[model samples]
Target chain A: MSLKRVGNQTVVFAKPPVILSSYSIVGPKEGQGPLGKTFDKVWKDALNGEKSWEVAESKMLQEAMNGAINQASVPKEQIDFMLAGDLLNQIISSNFAARQMALPFIGLYGACSTMALGIAVGSMLIDGGFAQKVLVGVSSHHDTAERQYRLPTEQGAQRAMSAQWTVTGAGSVLLGSDGAGPRVTSATIGRVIDFAVKDVNNMGAAMAPAVADTILNHFHDRQLRPVDYNLIASGDLGAVGLALACELLKQSGMNMGTNFTDCGVMIYDESQDTHSGASGCGCSSVVLAGDILQRIKAGKLKRVMLVGSGALHSPTSALQGESIPGIGHAVVIEG
Target chain B: MADQTQKKPLLSVTAEKYQTLIKQYTPKPTIIKNVVRAFIVGGIICSIGQIFINLFSSFGLARVEASTAATATMIFLGALLTGLGVYDEIGKFGGAGSIVPVTGFANSIVAPAMEFKREGYVMGVGAKLFTVAGPVLVYGITTSIVVGFVYFLLH
Candidate 1:
């Protein structure tokens, strides 16, 4: 079985999979952000009437997934697979949502990059003829991520200037071979690149190198220049990381001018006090499902490259003196 | 944690470049504003403690007793404010000023416990109760004991 491999690290789908439907739901805080109006649903309560924030995250994913399936007008039984994840221990949010939905599920954990991984795999499944229609979703709640990744908000802890606020939202995209929407044309799987950045507070620094590496690889593999795509977007590499990524890409002899932007940088208003910018799995997911796809459909962007970046570090790993390793997966979407 | 030196063989140059870029892009806090806020907030908290001391002293309490009463009262106020979720707001605006008070200590303990209350009392609230303020208490008690021992020896 010879897969249609690009130059290296990328797979080109002969028959690209179409994104049939997509739904985005954000919490009160994220609902008030720049992309607030673009989302399909915005919950008034961050807790979503749940007991704990973790459970609330699961609820968001459940709603987003159901909403996507409904928007696609596909029966639950007809959906062959569900690929989902979140920023939680064991990805409890996606797992819990899977239990509620009872769909054939594959749980993923790519830190903030879970959405890209899900869409990439879902696209592959559809393009390879394994499934006719697949569901891919990812979510992250600020409260849940705050407690798990750092100190609880109630602790009144001060965040570093480099720290990024985890986004409170969920986004789900339905992909099928037969639908009419922006198509997933190619995917570039990333390799773990550790630059020995150990500061848990500075996630942008930790993840920027991987974003640059993957983007460069995507360009090399597809034999495309920055001018080929109308937009080159990165997942959750906030203001700092976006700057670093742009510089790194430029040093490697590729120029990404105004075409380059980041989900982290665009999601929040500057006055929102999200030190660097917004992050988490939901950051890129909501932006892609809610804003970018809409722009593409409106004939604003013809081709776009979405690079999902993740800092693959645990608290235990950081405490044990391990340098944080990062990964960035890129998926090409053509309108 | 700071002792660990970053020494990736192949990517060291890239790391150096990234560090420079991060320093350039990361926002620096307004020091004057933060210092002024901290000073005002800290001074206000201390003044409230002084008021408690004066009230106790007026009620005919001895100097040491008055100080003790004021500290206890301040601690109570801090714990109350933390429980009501008001101290966190103060903390956001006041920074170290809010944290330097007895109330900040109360906020530290109650905040984690309250957030983790969903995990259950034993592992969640109970274990996490002392996480933020534990080191402060440990060092404070240890330093006092050392000082007491030195004074006893000198006397």
Candidate 2:
């Protein structure tokens, strides 16, 4: 079947980059709230310390980014660009991080969708001959997030079965113009999806609509079905969100069945008492950096679509009782 | 508080570190008959956990709390078996299919480190205490962090 390009073909994806280093930092056990240790440091500083959360988060992000870049055995001078983002208001996390990074930078605001969105842009830059070495990564946390949206980390509120476990970590990937990687084969930025569900406790309900619309738009643009890719991965939708997403896709006459897996669902053991499995910006990032990259390196999976869906909301919005406006971006990674 | 200054840290996923100890200490399962025996013993261990869960639930705990208690019970039993060297036999039979359960992980870790208890406090009690649980703590946190970041961004 012939493919129809969705957006302006300013750049056709070539080869992305390999994930040279991955680091995940968890919170205290059964703490009832969490965040990536460094992120929480920044968050706490923002909420309680001399510096803002953005400054703290960005500092930690740079530390993690440096950790990953150092692990890759690449010199700092070799990187061509820096791409980063998170759930902070107006992508301030990445903005602050960019200030410290002092590299050519692009700040993104995808809520939880930063990983895929970041990768998509990085790949485009690599494909369009815009960059040789682009550093892309994302982060999330439980404690800082809880403080931002719901209760304090010490609250110890009872979790519903559908509640998603917010992961505490950061993951970064270094994309270059050439060499070994999963290869950025194709991409589709579907029609922007927005809905009016804003309950902080029910993100799955809030984000599922966009997952449906964005995924459907991508499929329509590509003229491919769910089975075309070996894996149809979604970012940061826990077990319930995954189920809702599959149901919504099925409603569109595509039977994803068992093929659709959520980054939120894949990052943990079922028996971990994590409520509805993993959820975080890092949910997909680590899976992408740690496991998915390994699998791609091993040639086990081909043609994978990492769709990062995010909920754009703030503590003020939650308090003001405003509906959450969510978005999703699809980036295809192939061997 | 105990001075936590010194101790050789154990990496999580260090099953190879316990292999030698297991070979020397664990008794052969040939002393027992068949899967029935293994199942019976495993079943008994599991039953103890189930009873604990029920007991906890009966005391007005929620389902998750009860399950957590049950998990703790199973971990303790596995640790005991590991200490007695019987868990090695069960572990050989069950492989990870059985051992991947949190209880088995607890045993696999605690038994080996506790074996070095005779070496003294720093080596035995303080440092090696985490020999079994250390990696778990590491991976658990790392994994938790991974899951946390992913879900955190989803919002």
Native-interface RMSD of candidate 1: 9.7
lDDT (Cα, tens digit) per residue for candidate 2, span B1-155: 11234231111212233233223322243433434554665676677778998999999999999989889878787777677757666664544434556667776466546544445678655665564457778999999999999999998
Give the per-residue lDDT of model 1 (tens digit) for B1-155.
11124321122236667767767766786788889999999999999999999999999999999999999888888888878878888898899998988878888888888988898999989988888899999999999999999999999
Who wins the DockQ comparison?
Answer: 1
Worst 10 contiguous positions by lDDT, candidate 2 chain A? A34-43
DockQ of every model listed?
0.29, 0.01
**Which residues of candidate 1, in runs, are more than 4 Å off?**
B1-13
In terms of lDDT, which candidate is strongest?
1
Misplaced by over 4 Å in model 2 are: A1-11, A14-60, A90-92, B1-155
* Residue-by-residue lDDT tens digits, candidate 2, A98-174: 77778888887778888888887887777666778889877765545654555323221234555676665567878
lDDT of 1: 0.88
Worst window of 10 by summed lDDT in candidate 2 chain B = B6-15
Tens digit of lDDT per residue, candidate 1, span A1-335? 55677665788887999999999999888888888999999999888788989889999999999999999898999999999999899999999999999999989889998889999999888888999999999999998998887876776556778889999999999999887999999999888988778888889888988988888878777778889999999999898888888877777777788999999999999889988898999999999999999999999999999999999999889989998999999999999
In candidate 1, the residue pairs with backbone N, CA or C atoms under 3 Å apart (3 or more residues apart, or in different chains) clash, namely none
